[model samples]
Target chain A: MVPIYYYLILSAILFSIGVGAFLIKRNIISVFMSIELMLNAVNLTFVAFAHHWHQVSGQIFVFFVMVVAAAEAAVGLAIIIAIFRTRATLDVDRIDLMKL
Target chain B: MHLVLFFIFGGLCVAGALNLLFQRHPINAALSLIVVMSSLAVLYLLLGAEFLAAAQVIVYSGAIMVLFTFVIMLLNAGREDRTHGSKAAYLVGIPGAAALFATLVYIFLSYRTPLGDAGLGNYLVTTTDLSKVLFRDLLLPFEVTSVLILVAVLGAVVLARKEH
Candidate 1:
C-alpha cells in the first residue's frame, strides 16, 4: 500500500506545471489544455483523499467534474472557433480588439 | 509492488503533462494530454476507483481530447508565434508554481496523523457505489449538469455557425 501523500504530491506537481503553462503559453488552445490539466490534477487529489478516507462522495464529485469539463470543452472550443473566424489568428496576444 | 506501479503511472502522468506544456503544436499538445489522462486513469485504477478510471478514460481522454483536436483542426491554428507575456509571468510564474508545489508536498508529508491503515482495495469504489451515491446524494448536481450541457450545445451551435 502506497502512502496517500505520494498521489497528493504527484497531483500538486501536475497542477504546478499546468499553472506554469497556463501563464507562459501564448496560444489559447494550449492555455485551455492547461486548464484541463489543472482540473485533472485536482481530480487526482480528490480520488486520493477519497481512498484515504474511505468515502464515495469524492469519486462522485470527480464524475461531476468530468461532466462539467466535457460541457466546458464543447463551449470553449466553439468560442475558439468563433474567435478564430473573426480574428483569423489563434495567438492570445493578437486578439486584443476587446482591450480597453 | 504498489510503489513500482505508482512510479510507473505517476511518471507517465508527469511526463505527459510536461510534454503538453512545452509542445509547440496544439495537436501535439493534445496527444500528450491524452497520454496524461490515460496515465491518470491508471492511477485511479490503482487507487481502487474503477468507475472513475473508466470515466477518466472515456470522458476525458476520449471525448474531450477528440473535441479539442477537432477544434484545432477546424481553427487551422498554426504553430504559436512566441509572444512576450507580462513581465510577471516571466519573472514570477515558475517560482510561484514551484513554491506552490513544494508547499503542498510539505503539508501532505507533515500530516503525522495516522491515516488508520487504509489500504487500496477494489471495493473502495465500484460502479454500484458510485451510482448509488450519485443518484442518492448527488442527484441534483447530475440533473444540473444535464442542463448545463444542453446550454453548452446550444451556445456552441449559435457561436460557431456562420453569421449572416
Candidate 2:
C-alpha cells in the first residue's frame, strides 16, 4: 500500500508542471495541450480522493469533468482553427491584436 | 507491489509531462501529452478507478490527442520560435510554479496522517456500482451533459465552418 500523500504529491507536481508549461509555451496548440495536462492533474486528484474516502461520487465527478473536457477540446480546437485562419499563425505572441 | 507500480507509472507520468514542456514542436508536444495521458490512465487503474482508466485512454489519449495532431498537421505548424516569447515567463513563471508545488506538497504532507494509506484489493469500485449511482441518483446531470455535448458539437461545426 502506498501512502496517499504520494499520490497527492505527484498530482501537485504534475499541476505545477502544467502551469509552467502553460505560461512558457508560445504555440497555441502547445498551450492548449498544457491546459489538458492541468485538467488531467486535477482529475488525478479527484480520483485519489475518491479512492481515499471510498466515494463513488468522486469518480462520477471525474466522469463529468471528462465530458466537459471533451466538449472543451472540440470547441477550443475549433477556436484555434479560426484563429489560425484569421492570423495565419499559431504563436500566442504574434496572435495578439488587442495587447496594446 | 502496489507501491512499485505507483512509483513506476507516477514517474512515467511526470517524465511525459516534462517532455511535453520541453518539446520544441507542437507535434512532439502533442505526442508527449499522449504519453502523459496514457500513464495517467494507468494511475487511475492503480487507484482502483477501472472505468475511468478506460475512459482516460479512449477519451484523452485516443480522441483528444488525435484531434490535436490532426490540427497540427492540417495547419502545418512548425517548431516554435523562441525569440518572440516574453522573458518574464522564465523569470517569474518557473519560480512561481515551483513555489506553488512546494506549498501544495507541504500542505498535503502535513495532513498525511489523516489521509492514510490505500491498499489495493481491499475494496475495488466496480463499474456496476458506479452506474447505479450515476444513473439512479445523478440522472439529471447525466442528461444535462448530453445536452452539453450536443451544444459542443454544434459549436464546433459552426466555428470551424469556412467563412464565406
Candidate 3:
C-alpha cells in the first residue's frame, strides 16, 4: 500500500513541471503538450481521490475531462495550424501581433 | 507490491516529464509526452481505476498524441531556437511553479493523517460499474460531450480549411 500523499505529491510535481514547461517553452505544440501534461496530473489526482472515497463519480468526471480534452485538442491544433499558416513560425514569442 | 509498482511507474512519469522539458525538438518532446501518458495509464491502473487506465491509454496516448505527432510532422516543426524570451517569464514563471509545487506538497503532507493509504484489492472500479454510473447518473454530460465533439469537428474543419 502506498500513502495517498505519495500520489498527490507526484501529481503536484508533474503539474509544476507542466506549468514550468508551459511558461518556458517557445514551441506552440510543446506548450500544448505541457497543457495536456497538466490535465493528466489532475486526472491522476481525481482517480486517487475516487479510490480513497470509493466513488464512481470521480471516475465519471475523469471521463468527461478526457472528452473535453479531446475536443480541445482538435480545435486547438486546428487553430495552431491556422496560426502557422499566417505566421510561418511555431515560436510563441514571435506570435505577438496583439502586443502594443 | 503496489508500492513498488507505484514508485517505478511514478519515477517513469517524472522522468518523462523532465525529458519533455529538456528536449529541444517538438517531435522529441511529443515522444516524451507519450512516455508520460503511458506511464500515467499504469499509475491509473495502480489506483484501481481499470477503465480509466484503459481510457488513458487509448484516448490520450493512442489518439490525442497521434494527432499531435501528425500536426508536428505536417507542419515540419523543427528544433526550437533557444533564444531567451522576456525577462519576466524566467524571473516569474520558474519560481512561481516551484512555489506552487512546494505549497501543494506542504499542504498534502500536513494533512497526511486524513488521507490514509491506498492499496490494491480495496476498491477496484470495474468497467461495468463505471458504465452504470456514467450511463445512468451522468447521461446528460455524456450526451453533451458528444455534441461537443461534433462541434469541435466542425470547428476544426472550418478553421483548418484551405482559404482562397
Candidate 4:
C-alpha cells in the first residue's frame, strides 16, 4: 500500500492549484469551479485521515461536504445567472456594481 | 497496483486542474473540472472509501458539473478577457503558489516517518459500515443537510426566475 502521506501530498498540490486558479481566473464560473477544486482537495484529506484512523466519520464528513457543494452550486449558479442578466458580463472585474 | 493506479489518476487530476486554471473559455474549464472530480472519485475508491467514490462521481462530476455546464450555456459566458491582473499574477501568483506547495510538501514529508506508516489497517471501509455511522451517530447533521438542500432549492428557484 502507498503511504498515507502520498495522498496528503497529492491533495496539497491540488489545493495549491485550486488556490492559484481562484486567484488568477476572472470568469465567475471558473472561480466557482476553483472553489470546488479546493473543496475536493479538502475532502481528499478528510478521507485519507479517516482511513489512517480507521474511523468512518471522515467519510461521513465527506458525504456532508458533497451535499453542501451541491447546494452551493445551485445557489451560486443562480446568482451567476442573475449577475449576467444585470451586468451583461461574466467577468469578475465588471460585476462591481457597488464601485460607483 | 494501487500505487500505479494512484499515479495515473493523480497525474490526470493535476493536469486537468492545471488546464482548468489556464483555459480561456469557461466551458473548457468546466469540462476540466469534471475530469478532476472524476479522477478524485477513483482515488477515493483506492483509499477504501468506495461509497464516497461512487457519490463523488454521481453527485460531483455528474450532477454539480452539469449544473455548471447548464449555466455556462444559458448565460453564453465568454472567454475570460486578459486584464492587468494576469501580468501581476504571472509575476507573483505563480511563485507564491509554488512556494506554498513546496512548504506543504516538505512539512508532510518530514513528519510522515515520525508519525509512522500504515495507520490504515488492512480493512477497507465499506458502504454498510459507513451508512450505519451516518444514520446512527451523525443523524442531526444529516437531517440538517436535507433542510439545507430544501432551502437551496427554494433559493435557486427564487433567484433564477425572470423578473417582470
Report the CAPRI category for model 3: high
Off by over 4 Å in 2: A98-100
Fill in the DockQ of model 2: 0.86
How large is the interface RMSD of each prediction?
A: 1.6, 0.9, 0.9, 1.8
By TM-score, the better pick of 2 and 4 is: 2
lDDT of 2 at A69: 97
Cα-based lDDT at residue A15, candidate 1? 97
What tens digits encode model 1's per-residue C-alpha lDDT throughout B1-164?
77788899999999999998778899999999999999999899988999999989999999999999988887887788766764567578788888888888888878735643335573468788888878887788888889999999999899989999
Tell how far residue B50 is off in model 4, in angstroms: 0.6
TM-score (0 to 1) for chain A, all models? 0.96, 0.95, 0.96, 0.96
Candidate 4 has a TM-score of 0.95
Candidate 1 regions exceeding 4 Å error are B86-88, B112-118
The deviation in Å at residue B148 for candidate 3 is: 0.1
Q: For residues A1-100, what per-residue lDDT tens digits would candidate 3 score against the true structure?
A: 8999999999999999999999888899999999999999999999989988999988998999999999999999999999999889999889989633
DockQ of each two-chain model: 0.73, 0.86, 0.84, 0.72
Question: In candidate 4, residue A15 scores what lDDT?
Answer: 93
Ranking by lDDT: 3, 2, 4, 1
Per-prediction TM-score: 0.95, 0.97, 0.97, 0.95
What shift in Å separates residue B8 of candidate 2 from its native position after superposition? 1.1
RMSD of each: 1.7, 1.4, 1.4, 1.8
Cα miss at A100, model 4 (Å)? Answer: 8.0
Query: Candidate 3 on B2-35: residue-level lDDT in tens?
Result: 9889989999999999999888799999999999
Cα deviation at B132, candidate 4, in Å, is 1.2
Tens digits of per-residue lDDT for model 4 on B90-164? 677788888989998999999897544432236488889998888898899899999999999999999999999
